[model samples]
Target chain A: MSVSIDARGPRWSAAITAVVLATALVTSNLWVIAFQAVVFAIGAIRGPQFTPYALIFKKLIKPRLKSEPILEDVRPPQFSQAVGLVFALVAVIASITGAGGVFTIAVGFALAAAFLNAAFNFCLGCQMYLLILRVRTAK
Target chain B: MPDVHYAHIDAESHLELVRKLDIRSTPTTLFLNSAGVEVGRAMGTPKRAQVQAAIAAIH
Candidate 1:
């Protein structure tokens, strides 16, 4: 069995950047942003890889999203998609409560982070993993 | 040099595809001209400049 680590932010960042660029070019209305938020929330509600990488995550050496039982060898996804699901729930509630501006701004930041990964191969998710692991292992 | 579009090839079919070619390495690059004639080949990641030169020559 081969063990593979699933930690990279470039691909996800690339996807987010593409989403933002397309959205920014085609939309200026608050309702458009809210619609996009709802779409993303649906994805989160489904699961992590449910929205992005739904096709290839299963094929990669190390998946960034988990859709199957973790192999004895393959590393788990870097982030808990369940956590993202929770955020999606919060985002949906926030939008319904007329706080969509905050969630949209956060989505904007995620888009920026994706572009950063594309240009620099930086993985913000990996950094987040490091921080979480440190906190977990700290005595 | 052969220009290959690396598509998502599955492991089950990887060996079959490899056998059809003259490739002899885990990572092999084949260079070909517009006529589909091979001019150069290499094992593993070749220098970008070298690949460019081969394609330029073919062109």
Candidate 2:
């Protein structure tokens, strides 16, 4: 069965992700990136609805919003979360291996994707998912 | 200004351009010199200093 979700939930999650990534970049904290990786893993494995940020949005933010959110299929965002998980994992591994440049680049890419989603509602990973789907169906 | 010409391509409307450039993401900035040679690239939201440094490197 296809599952739909409040489109705003992913954006809200992305906003929190951007902040967390920016903090990780600024502080150069291995633990912070590691923590975000765990968050991404959870989101990827269990779905975006079960993510910590999504829980915060459901519990704290959604009730405060005045209007109903536009719902979207959860597949794209779930795929996006998986993409984020990959980047976060790469960053975490890079950090653990003391590969600073790789870690920075991975975190930078993740931060950029998150900022785009939060600010412009442009989900790069979602777009990528669509593109892949298109290619697969075309074949 | 400063011997630089800027062109903006709307990725949504210009799918051909996006495909031609192989642009996988939004807010991708490419630094090209006078000869149309790509010198540097910054993806996503780049800091002002990063842009400045990219420009400086090309010059």
Q: How does residue A62 of candidate 1 score in lDDT? A: 38
RMSD of each: 14.1, 12.3
Candidate 2 lands at a TM-score of: 0.69
lDDT of 1 at A69: 37
Q: All models: lDDT? A: 0.46, 0.82
Interface RMSD of 1: 16.1
DockQ scores for all the models shown?
A: 0.02, 0.03
lDDT of 1 by residue, B1-59 (tens): 24543333322235444545634432356776667677887653466788778767767
In model 2, which regions exceed 4 Å deviation? Answer: B1-59
- The TM-scores, one per candidate, come to 0.40, 0.69
- Where does candidate 2 clash, by residue pair? none
Poorest stretch of ten by lDDT in candidate 2 chain B = B9-18
Q: After superposition, how far is residue A139 of candidate 2 from its true place, in Å?
A: 2.7
- iRMSD (1 decimal) for each model: 16.1, 7.9
Candidate 1 A-chain TM-score: 0.49
